[model samples]
Target: MAAETKQSCYEGSSVSSFQFYLERSGEHEAILRCVRDVLPREFKRTGADKSSLDVLGVGSGGGQVDVQMLTMLQSTNPGVPITADIVEGSSELSDNFRALVEKTPNLEKIPFAWNIMHSGDYEKAVQAKGNMKKFDFIHMIQMIYYVDDLADTIKFYHSLLKSNGRLMIIVEGEKGGWDTLWKTYQKELCVDAITQYRSSGEVIACAKSLGLKYEELPVPNQFDITDCFDPSSQTGERLLNFMTAKDNFYESLTPEIRSGILDLLRHKCSTEKDGRVMFDSKLSCILIHA
Candidate 1:
């Protein structure tokens, strides 16, 4: 559906609403699995020397995924101290993440330094402080959409990596259902004020163009969106908002546009089996080696 003027839907979204969206859409589970699968390949200890690792978590929301990764890293290198620089914009998310760290016993093993700022802001602050801190591992988990220049941001983060360090990026695959839907309707559905939709395919191409050393891995995932068919369901409506990045997506769209989107979701984006709708919500993990 087309609007006379486009607007950002996420401006009014609350932390709880976003969390609910993640939990209901099966995104949380998929991300956790992706992190687990990708960590061992890069975070494992080498030889007998215990290594002290510095990690930079870009746009690490609420620290759920960060905590998991840190736990894995700590387990991989026992007794090795870890310094985590968590970069996040939202105060609510940062506070929630700190609270989680205080409560979780496993997270206690790793000492953390919370950089309560956006990635760019943190970089600027570090530069101002004349600190040349390099990271052993840096992860940007589905957070590049908020960045102004994805390629430049990638290059800057890559430069922050130490020798043999890994910069892991997790985003939706180009041919996945979310990517297809976002690409098709982005012009009409996305907020004009924000950057258009981005996928792992574009990031990989950027890495190749930059001549960066990288490897791509497919992360199998699916979201059961059967509840989205019910227009009156609040969960369904919120899920739609999350998917389209539009506030009240069902309500905002024109009848024809809404129908078209629904048709695409039913036939192309998802498959119906055993009376349930499952979207091929696969993710891509790009490991850029320094």
Candidate 2:
């Protein structure tokens, strides 16, 4: 994973800011590959020489995935021109995307433009920055949960996509590995409930209602920070820094509960037998095409 300037990372100065994500691009690369492989499925061949292939990368955070996707497309076909629109709400992240793509060799040469938009203002934003009709691929990854009106948003994206073009939504599955980690540490962490979109089922149902073809892709992930537990070790320093930055997560609990939870996490992360900290995380990729 490559690092970027601190100011060009995320939208805000939250504890879990975009800077943390920059160092974890290696982990996220697999998800990008999976999405790329699944996204083209929605597009059906209309003709041989000319097929309008437009890609709308919704909620394109950090722009790392966008660069990777474009690189993949260019590698497959150098002369291909993909009408790519990067629709992102975070101005900081959007700027990062622009900088990264401009610096990347093959990615910079690709014939595509990035149109950044705030995640909240979709309608007017699109009107101001994008074109209507159908897109070849519309990707929304780890972003629908932030949307206040999920169905309406999907409908709007549906309108932007052409026939056989796909609207792909990738989210962390409720029953996936994240839940397992939450369950494992819930009691220990003094968290009664976790926050996430309700379920992947609703995404599928919502897509179906829009008369789009649907497919689900399952992806799993985990963190193994064994080397970092030695206190003097620096192997997984990137992951460790991420964990430290998340200390404010304890703010969700009462003082007493927070203390207890912290102690438990410390134990789990630094015991003699299990000197490694592990978390199970999994995501679901839902692809919808008209």
Candidate 3:
């Protein structure tokens, strides 16, 4: 099937825009930390110790996640070198990624390489010619939902992993803020995100169907850094507002419905028993070997 141009464009832009959000949430750090915590044990047991450790980050643009991942890797093992092969889909974002990495300390110490591979066409890169081929870990965060064929795409990733290597996918869970907002105003939210709503469950099930043993890591709301929205901060204002705006119920909404969404978020952020805006979310890491 041909790639969804409009959706792909939206995703490319969204991933670029989300670079700022990832930095702000310290989510980049949290994820890398999790990888470090589990990777060594997993690798040692799987006999990846002698093998050169390489990481392939799909949808890795602007090196936002790269900085965090590399920083965490260095802290854990300064002598241990990592080969970070980043496959970014957008040329513009890929350039930005290169610039960002240049400023990170000792990033050069590790082998950080990247290419412009449209995420949807990532299979081509994995199958490309080279000794730096395959990977110990292939990571995708908040990006898999855009693929037209989740099962085929995931299976492809599974095929690229070095023996006992892991294919990790981190997505907003079924009960996440993404889903909660959509559920609250499904009619509005569904307008623009119907595909996302429809495919969220299927992606998880797709992995299970393949017999990919996985771990569902719950990262939860964890966005406890502020109150109200700070327009200057990426996640604080843009993300919060985007979630409220994308409610197809909110977008397709008349002025009245738009106003209702605003009012609800306001109330939820204020008087709700959770004391904080309650948004349910989870992240999963699916491990496999080729």
Q: Using TM-score as the measure, which candidate wins?
A: 1
Who wins the lDDT comparison? 1
Looking at model 2, the pairs that clash are: 89-118, 89-119, 134-161, 134-162, 135-161, 135-162
Report the lDDT of model 3 for residue 36: 69
TM-score, per-candidate, Cα-based: 0.90, 0.70, 0.71
TM-score of 1: 0.90
Count of steric clashes across candidates, in order: 0, 6, 9
| Quality of model 3 by C-alpha lDDT | 0.59
Model 2 scores a TM of 0.70
- Native-to-model Cα distance after best TM-score fit, residue 42 in candidate 2, in Å: 6.4
Cα lDDT tens digits, model 3, 91-112, are 6667777888788888877676
How accurate locally is residue 62 in candidate 1, as Cα lDDT from 0 to 100? 80
Computed on alpha carbons, the lDDT of every model, listed in order, comes to 0.77, 0.57, 0.59
**Model 3: ten consecutive residues of lowest lDDT:** 1-10
**Which residue runs does candidate 3 get wrong by more than 4 Å?**
1-26, 29-33, 43-48, 71-81, 124-132, 183-187, 190-194, 198-201, 222-237, 244-252, 256-278, 286-290
Among all windows of 10 consecutive residues in model 2, the one with the lowest summed lDDT is 1-10
Regions more than 4 Å wrong, model 2: 1-9, 21-26, 36-52, 109-114, 127-133, 177-199, 209-211, 225-247, 256-275
